[model samples]
Target: MANENGEGEDIPVAANVLGTIGTILWCIQLVPQIWYNWRRKKTEGLPASMMLLWATCAVPLGIYLVLQNVNIPLQIQPQIFGALSYVTWGQILYYDHGYSRLKAIVVVLAASAISGGLEALFILTLRIPYRKGTTWPALFFGIIAAIMLTLGLIPPYFEIRKRHGRVIGINWFFLAIDTFGALFSLFSLAAQKSFDILGGVNYILVALLEFGIYGCHTVWRIRNRKLLREAKKSGRSVDELLEERELERQRQRELESSNGERFTGIDYDEEKSRPSTEAHSVDGGFVQEPAGWHRT
Candidate 1:
């Protein structure tokens, strides 16, 4: 193959093959998270900052990959990643933070526009005479993206710690898939005629972070299953145990409200004072009272 400077270079076929696999993996990496959020109808423990930073990082990454004349699949990979990340971020805002649908949509659009515009500006600026034939600009942006990716995992790590080692609201399968994708991307980078040092480091860090998350998730699941078994032994269903937990959480919120915590729009006192009503099991594994009725 011929380099951009018209010099002869041996491009490995394996590099392109691995890059294609990495591209495919990256494209679908977010699907599990998206599906998990949709099915759960919540994003409680997911970090919006992580998604936002990663999405922003992708703008520079895409520009760098394209400017370096990487394979077409690699060039397109970051765009897909950014778009999906924005969607995940929007889900967090809408479901976890209770943003209105219109507000979430506006925010996602604004972010996408800003990132895309910045990437375009960089692409144009890097095409100037002095920067045109050099790899410095691409390398600089790639390093920046790598740093952003490494830092993005910090919030999620803290979130897990704050939850007492419980991996709530995170989909382990998603993390596993993402880690594998990062591993494949590292292999792809290694097979290149000139390996991307920054990219390889970024993928390695991402894979390690994701694997750590998976480990935490496994431990959390084991703990939860043990608790569920204990509940069963006590003649209680898991749903009942979960409902108790929810009630406890609600009571804690009420206590906070009484102690001058911010208003949450719910009249906790009124709910508490309502007349007793029979609880009925619902298909979703929760207990509910009849409409116009309340539990004492």
Candidate 2:
């Protein structure tokens, strides 16, 4: 990413242009998901860990890009990404984790301060080595950023792979924009005077992971379309059917976890915590249970 001149070197026009566009897209890529979370008042499908991981990665990434003296857009992308990631993470804590507004705001502010301080320290420390013509520190930060970025996209796969599950919290618009941003970043690297292998690999890995997410999105769409048709014929709204489906899955899980006991809208331990050595039937009958069933 550094030129022989190390500063004020002319970058290719195409690289500059593509980097600009990619930067713009990346800046807004998370906006849709943030807005969706605000409107939905929850963050079910979107894991807070993913956003936190991204924010964590951005610190080192920003340090690396700035130290490497990459093009202006690439230099600033991590900073903006980190800020928005904190916002999204704040929303998740507030809505999904039941944190109070004040608590969530405090947490986000603390995180931002810590990351900003860390990035500053890293950049300052790495600049000394960079000025000494030692590039390993920059490379180290780049490698760390790449690994974090790759790991950040894994949590959502666990959600989407569940039975009859759909991509619930993440917005497709956000994903589409992100994919375009990745492609543009890759193209910018291709157009650059020096190909940054770390940067190129980072972008390529994200784009490929995003392709799998898009495929997951496609499967959800197909299943949802079928359910929509069924909803019409069954005189039930899609929401109702989806809710019923989720309840059914929850019941099945509870049933399996309780060793053939039925779910009755209460916690398993609470339901079985009675001192009597009998399980109460729905019809108010007392059925004998196995010994020590109440303890577990």
Write down the lDDT that model 1 would get. 0.77
lDDT of 1 at 161: 89
Candidate 2: worst-modelled 10 consecutive residues by lDDT: 1-10
* Candidate 1 displacement at residue 262 in angstroms: 32
Clashing pairs in 2: none
Candidate of highest lDDT:
2
| lDDT of candidate 2 over 1-296, digit per residue (tens) | 11111367577888778877777888889999899999999888898999999889888888888987866766777888899999999999999999999999999999999999999998887798798899988778878988998899998888788734466678889989988988887898788778877768878888998898888777777867988899999999777998899899999998797865445445567657755465656568777775567643
Write down the TM-score of every candidate. Answer: 0.73, 0.77
Model 1 C-alpha lDDT per residue in residues 1-296, reported as the tens digit of each score: 00111124565777656656666877778889999999988998889998998889898787777777655666777898899999999999999898998999999999999999999888887866324467777778878878887888878888988765667777877776677777777887777778766667778888788778778767876878877787879999665887788899999998987766434434666666775566676676767564667556
Q: Candidate 1: minimum summed lDDT over ten consecutive residues — where?
A: 1-10
Q: Model 2, residue 137: what's the lDDT?
A: 86
lDDT of each: 0.77, 0.82
